[model samples]
Target: MKVIRIAAALLIGPDGRTLLVRKRGTQAFMQPGGKIDAGESAAVALVRELNEELGLIVDPTEAQFLGEFSAIAANEPGFEVNCQLYRLDVAQDVMPAAEIEEVVWVDAGGTDELHLAPLTRDSILPLYRSLQSA
Candidate 1:
């Protein structure tokens, strides 16, 4: 099986909701991030992906590293995604751009209504909720 290396952000708004994005023509909504480029750090890749996909400017220094996670690929069959995830608190407005077709800010109790990526559904969300209670 192929493993795709990616950096993702769990962007929390002032109201405590985290942002999730769905790519164009894709049904699974995942974190707003993409694959890391060669020679780029995960934090830097997340900064770039935030600007490109959500029109949000982020400084690499402002993001908190949340460690790595791996799960079955959300949109890819027989593949896995290995993600270096970060948590960022933001107050700025964001607009969907690039390949991102829709964006939603969801609270912990509200995820069951939407189709989520395996990483988000199985790993990230659970981790987020755990952190929230700590």
Candidate 2:
């Protein structure tokens, strides 16, 4: 089995909704970040991914490390993904571009309404819930 490693962000807004993006030609919504680049730090990859996926510039100092998780890829078969999660607070108004088809701000209670990646549904959502209650 091949494992894919990625770095992702759990961007939270003042409204307490989490930012999610639907990639082009994909039905499920996922976190804003993407694969970690060779010779790049996780934080750097995350910052670059945020800008690429959502057109938002995030200050690295503002991002908090959540943890690492692994799950089966939502859109791929026989492939697994390991992701390092981080949470950041940002403005609610954002324009998603690059390969993202649509962006949604979903409340923690409404996670079920959004089709999320396995890692997101299993791990990230729980963290989001905890943050909401904190």
Candidate 3:
């Protein structure tokens, strides 16, 4: 199985909601990110991805490292994904751009209704919830 290495962000708003985005032609909503390019640091990749995918400007130095996680890939049936995830608490406005078709702000604990990527559902959200309760 192939491994997709990515850098993603858990974007939190002033209202305490987190953002999830659905790419065009994809059913499962996931964190806004993309594959880490060769020689690019995770934070830099995440900042670039945020700008390209969500039309949001961010500083790489401000992204709080939330550790790495791995799960079965959401869109690739036989592949896996390893994500370098970060928590970014920002109140900036975001619009879906590039491949993103839809964006949603959801309560961290109230995401049962949406079809989420496996990485988001099985790992990231649980971690986020635990961090919230800490």
Candidate maximizing lDDT: 1
- Against the hidden true structure, what lDDT does model 1 obtain? 0.94
Model 1 lDDT tens row, 1-134? 99999999999999989999999999999999999999999999999999999889999999999999999998889999999999999999999999999999998888999999999999999988887778
Q: Which stretch of 10 consecutive residues in model 3 shows the poorest summed lDDT? A: 125-134
lDDT digits (tens) for residues 11-99 of candidate 2: 98887788888999998888889989899878889999998888889988788999989999988889998888889999847787888
Best by TM-score: 1
Q: Which 10 consecutive residues of model 2 have the lowest summed lDDT?
A: 108-117
Question: Candidates 2 and 3: which is better by TM-score?
Answer: 3
What is candidate 3's lDDT per residue for 1-134, written digit by digit as tens?
Answer: 89999999999899878899999999999999999999999999999999999888999889999999999998889999999999999888998899999999988678989999999999888888887777
Candidates in order, TM-scores: namely 0.97, 0.94, 0.97
State how far residue 89 of model 1 sits from its true place (Å): 0.3
Q: Model 3 residue 31 lDDT? A: 92
Model 3 scores a TM of: 0.97
| Residue pairs clashing, model 3 | none
Candidate 3 lDDT (Cα, 0 to 1): 0.92
lDDT (0 to 1) per candidate:
0.94, 0.86, 0.92
Q: For all candidates, what are the clash counts?
A: 0, 0, 0
